[model samples]
Target: MVTKLPLAVLLSASMLLSGCTVVDLDENGQPILPKDPAAKASFSSQTPQQIAQENWDSRVLKGAQDRALTWNDMKNKSTALKAETSSSVFVKATGTVTAVSDDAERERLLTVTINGESVPVAIGPVIRSNAIRDAAGFKFEEFTNQVQFARLTKALNQQNVQQLPKIDGSWVGKPVQLTLAVTLQPQRIEDAVAVVIKQEQP
Candidate 1:
């Protein structure tokens, strides 16, 4: 007499022998579904959910593209194309506060040059510390502005790249470079602070 095996046990045995299906992983860790041969000839195959997911993912990384113009990229592109310097500012200076009478009322405008382009930047006349005083410190207004600049730098660095630029058919065989564009406005901060500027007596 032939005995009938339980349906559940038979299904489990088949699955074990066949091995459960594994999805393929793409470069971005996304699961790539197998393309069906039968579906190739068919029309109207895409679903609404798939379209929605694509749109949602595209919007998430838009900001990364805007803030990623690095100096190296500009320099490299500058060689190939005409590039212009837009914003340059002298963020810090340690020279003696000369002519602090009328100009002391507002921030002093100083010319900052980068790549031979001169940029005018205004710096605060507020003195955080006096040379005559034993303790040296930055003035309140200038100190606050410096803090704001630091925060902006931090925020931009943490941003993610959203969408990459489009590549054409001509460059299909060529290798393309992907780089982070971090354009920091030129600001002369405290690279190294000196308490005293020594001069040799002639």
Candidate 2:
């Protein structure tokens, strides 16, 4: 014999199984929901360049400033500073290029001087790191390896390089403003590589 259930019990069971009590359907049978205003606003406000610049300014620039050191400071207190900070230090310097390395196949290292102390800036061949991204408050676990990080670095490097003068004989004496993310290892400041290099407009 079949047992009949009450209307209220059947409706409750159906609602529980469906996982939704109310579903507003449009004329076309699709869900009728309001557009997300916040999503729309975000989409309209953030351009690719603006987003990238924000990341650069907030993460890369701020990260550098957190433990900033001058060329002379790094030279004299490399060991002490590295031991104290135990992370990459950002170096900001305005200097003229005294020499440019002859290596064309690999990264181009520009030897510049701030108060007569030499600092090398690396340009190209490889721009890979999540240091800036991490500094921008992004977690590495969100990505699969360095692919996204590499893309960010590559775009940044390209934008910076485009604004810089060619690394040739002519660039040897030109003034440049460099902001670098330098690894604090082996107690050497000259081994620092520039993450951003901008030529001072004369």
Candidate 3:
């Protein structure tokens, strides 16, 4: 049967179709949010763990494979490398482990020698650098907020550390091959391994 519809109802449906949110207001003219969420309630998250899952394969490992600078190139010719690099870079290093810091596992550091350059690599229970995050080449301005940016940093660090093999004093003299994320104008011995992809030890 043909029936006439209210103009208001038609207009409301049109507004909804146009992506306008249907918010309810209270007496004071403020939004009256829902008490219990509905089935379609949604939230967005890119936590460290989630981030790790998304980027670990295509971005972290693969990207490192494509964009990494040799340890010697990163250390000896950094200025020239920086001039050519317009974004984040990975430093690939392979060397024998010389020492391991006994600090909290999160704060642990492993010393390795690559191309005669001895440096500390942080394999964290707590990573203190933004190596992987920055190496992803994301711009800070594009982040919705500092909190999101921090989440990305945590995510990258988590992704990298998850790939690390177990380590201890026994690992000394074992050959380790890893990738690190470092800035063009690095100050510290460069942040440690973004990931330990190969460990030549039993």
Candidate 4:
């Protein structure tokens, strides 16, 4: 005669046969599974752009206070003050447009003076630095080359010029505010080769 197994034994045997572990359930009956080690590893290895994007709202926006610096302060105190004041290499400066370059190259330059020091802002047809990508939290590595960079910058430049039509000429001598992405090697700050310029409303 065949004998029936106990309900507990039957359940245990079924679980063992299926190689399944008991899943803990929440009060609402949702199964809770262990976090995947691979996913955790992948998250930890996220790219700079990804990390920057994730922290953009908190770190770049709300956490860090805007520090207004003169061009001289930027030239002299960029390294020291940046470390003490903010986590980002980006900064905001207000000044009069003392000069603007007439170069028709993909990269255009604008010079502004604050406290008699000149700061240059580059608007691009060819954006070379990763400054904007880092500052704006873009996935630049996905583009990977000059052609892609050129395409992206061209599109950006077209859109920006529409808003500030005469960025090179009309904006000169006007009091303006700029949010720039700075680079220490050559020691320059620019418009991130995009729409980083704003004319102070009268």
Off by over 4 Å in 4: 1-77, 81-88, 137-166, 185-195
| lDDT rank order | 3, 2, 4, 1
Q: lDDT by residue for model 4 over 88-108, one digit each (tens)?
A: 245666778877767577667
Which RMSD values do the candidates have, in order?
22.2, 10.8, 10.9, 9.1
Backbone clashes in model 2, listed as residue pairs? none
Error of 2 at 115 (Å): 3.6
lDDT of 2 by residue, 137-186 (tens): 44533333455544555565555444444566677888988776655544
How many residue pairs clash in model 1?
Answer: 5
TM-score comparison, 2 vs 3, better candidate? 3
Candidate 3, clashing residue pairs?
48-155, 106-125, 106-126
Q: Which stretches of candidate 2 lie over 4 Å from their true place?
A: 1-54, 61-68, 72-77, 81-86, 102-104, 128-165, 195-202
User: lDDT by residue for model 1 over 49-104, one digit each (tens)?
Assistant: 33223423242223223333343444443344323432211112212111212343
Task: Give all candidates' CA lDDT scores.
Answer: 0.30, 0.61, 0.70, 0.55
Question: What TM-score does prediction 4 earn?
Answer: 0.47
- Give the Å error, residue 11, model 3: 34
TM-score of every prediction relative to native: 0.22, 0.50, 0.66, 0.47
Better of 2 and 4 by lDDT: 2
TM-score of 3: 0.66
Evaluated against the true structure, the overall lDDT of model 4 is: 0.55
